[model samples]
Target: MALQNGFVRKEGIPPKSRSRRPAPDRRYERLLARQGLAPTAGVDEVGRGSLAGPLVAAAVILPLRIRLHPWLDDSKRLDSRRRLSVCDWLVGLPGVAYGIGFASVEEIDRWNVLGATMLAMSRAVLALAEKPGVVLVDGREAPPLEMPVRAIVGGDRRCASIAAASVLAKVTRDRWMTEVGRDHPRFGFARHKGYGTDDHWEALRRYGPTPLHRRSFLGRLSEEAIPHLPWDDGAIEPRGGP
Candidate 1:
């Protein structure tokens, strides 16, 4: 019911509180489909901004006749219940082909977040059952892949296929983090899903970084103050700062 400030809210005007963006349409997909790129896959990744856990990417190709669900939007905009429901529907819906890939915490430390994210995206695309004619990536830069790829900024909010990928990737990663939380309950992976929340920060100080925690993400943590994990990086970069 509220228009986002960046898109429609005017300076000095009362902010409209639209929780979700407008439903993504198939405009981009159709544009490419008309040009003989009928089987285009939408690409997106989750956990790129998280302080811990593996980055997950997904590529989704919808059938020619798609009737998008009304509640579908970027993963961040949906509640847990809605996200799970949409994910179930999308995964089960006929004529849809999807693939998910992950880049581990170790890979993030070795290659940096961007590189690892790209690697995950590439894997997802390659894993697809039907090779796509083109890829509509939901970011400013496309991953290095041997295919026709186009990056559309805010694509998850503007493209149906990209939105579906966002939902699938998010649901998949969230489920994983929740399960991992069961094994290591101290970090509250279930609550924060590996983000640097206040609870997570407190736990990190108390228990130190776990195997799931990125050593490269330790810039926010004091090197002298916190207990060192076995694989601590002495000179961690300050990417995705606190």
Candidate 2:
């Protein structure tokens, strides 16, 4: 990964040995540290591509002396079990400060996904228990904030702090969706986590969109007309009345 014009540009990484897991680069942090940017935070968001659920962001400031877990990587690269394990361990580590922020479905609908994402990122940064001197966001764009920020395109894969943020965001959001699944078992929220999976598509067609489903996202599906009771704003509420 490289930084160009304030965006993190991503390039393919060479295949790693099968026996050993690849490690995220620490140079991004080191470079900042050299410039006296101690307590730099890495921020990342998850659920942007999902068809439903809130966009969640996490910001984490890792301590200089703490050794990161070897299994850490992009959250997408880890299984559900591993992600949960890593999230649990990361939150408990001493000198690790973190916070989570969410942009609701309503917010996404109102602001558009990009705007909502930035809002979520900003909230994550502000929610941090320990303030950071600088923020490293994983993507082509950085959220607008008063503090200094750098956008690393492949930060989740190339930067350890961003990878840690990814894990935290993913795990936290996944757990939320699982609880939502329990509330609305018919939609299989736990199974697909609100992504546009075939099962989710089928559910949409069969049962219509859930109350939490993104109305804008539904237009893109174009698979079937999402059933919306006239009073329900095109999304099916889980109430008993047809």
List model 1 lDDT by residue over 200-222, tens digit each. 88888887887778889878889
Residue pairs whose backbone atoms clash in candidate 1: 2-17, 2-18
User: Per-residue error at 29 for model 1, in Å?
Assistant: 0.7
lDDT of 1: 0.85
For model 2, state the Cα shift of residue 154 in Å.
0.5
TM-score of each: 0.86, 0.85
Which stretches of model 1 miss by more than 4 angstroms? 1-20, 232-242
| lDDT of each residue in 1-242, candidate 2, tens digit only | 87655767677744334655567867888888999887789999999989888889999898877888878899989988888788888988988988888888878888999998999899889988888989999999898888899998888998999999999999888888887678679999998999999989888887887767887788755644555522254432221100
* Whole-model lDDT values for every prediction: 0.85, 0.83
Looking at model 1, how many pairs of residues clash?
Answer: 2
Error of 2 at 92 (Å): 0.7
lDDT of 2 at 117: 92
